[model samples]
Target: MDTLNSGSGKLVGLSFEMGPIRPPSEGGSYSLLIRVTRNCPWNQCTFCYGRPYDHEKFQMRSVDEVKADIDTAGLLCDEIKNVSWELGYNGDINTQVGTALIRRMPQLGNSHSFINVFNWLHSGARTAFLQDADTPIIPTPRLVEIIRYLREKFPSLERVTSYARAKTIFKKKEEDLKDLSCAGLTRLHIGLETGDDELLWKVKKGVTAEEHIVAGRKVMEAGMELSEYIMPGLGGRAMSRQHAENTARVLNAINPDFIRSRPFTPLPGTPLFDVYMNNELELLSPHECLEEMKILIAGLDVTSRICFDHFRNPSYLNAPGQLVHLLKQDYDGYKLPEEKGSLLEFIEKGLRIGEEKFLKTESYQL
Candidate 1:
């Protein structure tokens, strides 16, 4: 009997101890997602999808529900191991290896369901994703209990990460943040979307530029890794300079651990979508956005690692490791072979070209 086939009757959202979850972000990978929270607490960002069910109303998984999912994950792991061994595939190639592997093996299509479940269970999945948008809204004590429980279940837990709005962080006392950090809340992902105060107000980010800096600093001060998401074209055509300037100012103030550049792509149904529909918002084309990023990077004071580890970003510009390498040297040594010109020069050229093209083409294929 396929060990995977043995447990097909288990319920959805049930806990098992075998496989992994969640999609990878631009700069880093996602573990088997154990969604702790249900929906985004602050659903005001113009770009976010919020929860799969409701984008506006924030919700959270009950403590009981979270425990149940963890339980299910444990059981699933055992089944995956049994199946892998029975198939003469033991050791390295087991449920713990990941679902990506099982999917690649065409012979496992019938067994894919089991393999997938196993992947979710065993893939170094100690990281739990606090669901919804602003999981920081969860009460610190309660959140701590959840973290503690997960740690007890998986002692090797590397990080328990969540998303939060700047206002949410600002609202929480510094002590509370430190308490959460002490309780094993490892990192907080903030969508600083754009640091431009005017654009932030326009986008209804629910926090001022100063609040973003303060919140980021607090997270870092609390000894938690602060990962900020910076959207390139959030300012659009009118306030691009202000957007880059403001963002650089905020990042310089906090000097966050990770500055992940997420070039804005306005999906339909959001406020930005409405703006585009009404011909009110003139979005930056891919090339123009690169120019904007160049300006943003130029303005940043040398400090954290800047990452363009996402797909939507243009390669003509990159972090250039300037923060660490530049003050000692100058911009002369900051060239990435994948990029076209000097960061500033590339931006200027891209702006002059005006036409936008995706990075991939037959001529560009390696």
Candidate 2:
């Protein structure tokens, strides 16, 4: 069974193991996920649920193990390419339409369901995401090799992204970052959860605001698309102002390609949730979150596309629409920098509408 069967099972004998998930944008864009690392190196962010803090050890898979995964995925992609060509399904081969093709192809009904993902992949995915919390910690040379090998296998892929802790990226030498960017690692997603040092300390976010800027600038200098995540309610009520203002200032400093606002919602497993329960940390009401967001937007000066979003998007192919549409980013369909006056006015109006108002714009954060 190591060889692929056109309509039945995988061609390879080694079963692939999927690690933690990714941002919804990846799914919407039909980006395939390849887990290059296991769990996060630092999982102490108060709002996080990554492994080191909860379960699992921080470990890096050997290059050979990763290559095996790529090898298996490559065979699957190759099979899909051939079958798609044979079937005359010539549409741009991303996952969504590819799945549709599989469902329509009655001949494959007898095959295992898992095999369909590879078949779906055949629609030719040009984008992929290296996952589980962060992968930049993968030694730069090995990381470069992995990226190069992946590109060789999936020649059609135009970009590959992986989450990188701001500290991890900051630790890399300038030349390594530049060379890695050139080696096919197209984008870096850094969880710059809060750019305010005070709040950063409170949340145990390891890196400071200056470090965030340092890492981000290096990514841009290396010509890699950087998506920096900012959590709106992370400061809660006590430090809300600093959270918004400093975050904007930092964004201005780094000017990442995409500033994705992941609205703060303290989940049960995280330390922040315990703080919320004890009333030690005041959670931001939706209205308060809106107010903080307003401050952040007003202070932002970068040309980066601001995505008022998190992972839980509503419909397929639909980005959890922004507070207002602005400039668009090519990687994951982001909107940024709407007119300040009109945007604030719109937000104020939404605040007036209140929690009773069920809107995607207000509840975009999860």
Candidate 3:
């Protein structure tokens, strides 16, 4: 490991590879991020068009490379704990220890790796997220080795999760999925996007609705929690009803542990943005999006938590002129069947607030 001499003491040169993004829930929990792969394996999907990875080619890091990163992160954690001890915090990582360590090693302030590790340690280091789009796309044995190695390095990790493609999960054998679960992969966040076959084909999602159900059920059977992402307004106005109804139908069949809503916004530079510019597809208005959500929620028969955890989910202005979100926006979200009535009432409240109080989809463009 590299080292830097600071005025107070020696500091390990903490540098490790990290991916562009993880699920918002992972961010909320301050999960330690490990980049097992680089970029996305499948960069299609007109909606995203792989913009997050800058359309870079996907590449798998050798097991040694990933292990080295994990080791570096572990070293950083040890160094931080040492600093805490020297600061009289008795090895407790906290705001004071973090601030003092950064003051002693100013370079840490600019290190994303240090920031991620520090925040994760401060947050209890109970979880981790494997990064880049589809981690399970790696060979089963190698992926298992990585997960086990991660757990071995950080025994405090209680949950490990990753973003996976449904088609990839469907391609895996049941025994392989069980191996992954046994290796400590606790959850998978999949982009079900929409279950309408027409919309799925139009968006080049590369997976069918049946494939989603099969993959979801397989994960559940493997004893791994599954979170399916649904994109409201993905079908636009033309297929809104079908999109909502079919997506709920698919989720109902799978009964995933969590159903996350990611309201669609046509980001510039994506193929869908060009389609929107050409007026080939119409975006849903705020009220229409809420109505579509109402249809989707009413159709859900699952026992999952439905979350609107993303900022892109619909919001409105209250009488006090302050911005307000329609849904709770928590990671756990609202429980279905029990809180279903209350969630529907929230949608109704948003609908009654009228379209004028809400921002247009175009306003969300980046």
Best by TM-score: 3
Instruction: Report the C-alpha lDDT of model 3 over 125-187, residue by residue, as the tens digit.
Output: 999999999999999999999999999999999999999999999999999999999999999
- Each prediction's TM-score versus the true structure: 0.76, 0.82, 0.97
Tens-place lDDT digits, model 2, residues 9-123: 3333324555656765676566767778888888788878563325577889888888888886766655555555544554234554345445655444443323534533643
Residue ranges of candidate 2 with Cα displaced over 4 Å: 1-8, 11-14, 51-54, 85-123, 311-338, 358-366
Taken over the whole model, the C-alpha lDDT of each candidate is: 0.64, 0.71, 0.92
Candidate 2, 192: how far from true, in Å? 1.0
Order the candidates by lDDT, highest first: 3, 2, 1
Q: CA RMSD for every model? A: 7.4, 5.5, 2.5
Greater-TM-score candidate between 1 and 2: 2
Residue 148 of candidate 2: its Cα lDDT?
Answer: 91
lDDT head-to-head 2 vs 3, winner: 3
- Provide the lDDT at 159 for model 1: 78
Error of 1 at 238 (Å): 0.7
Alpha-carbon deviation at 233 in model 2, angstroms: 0.7
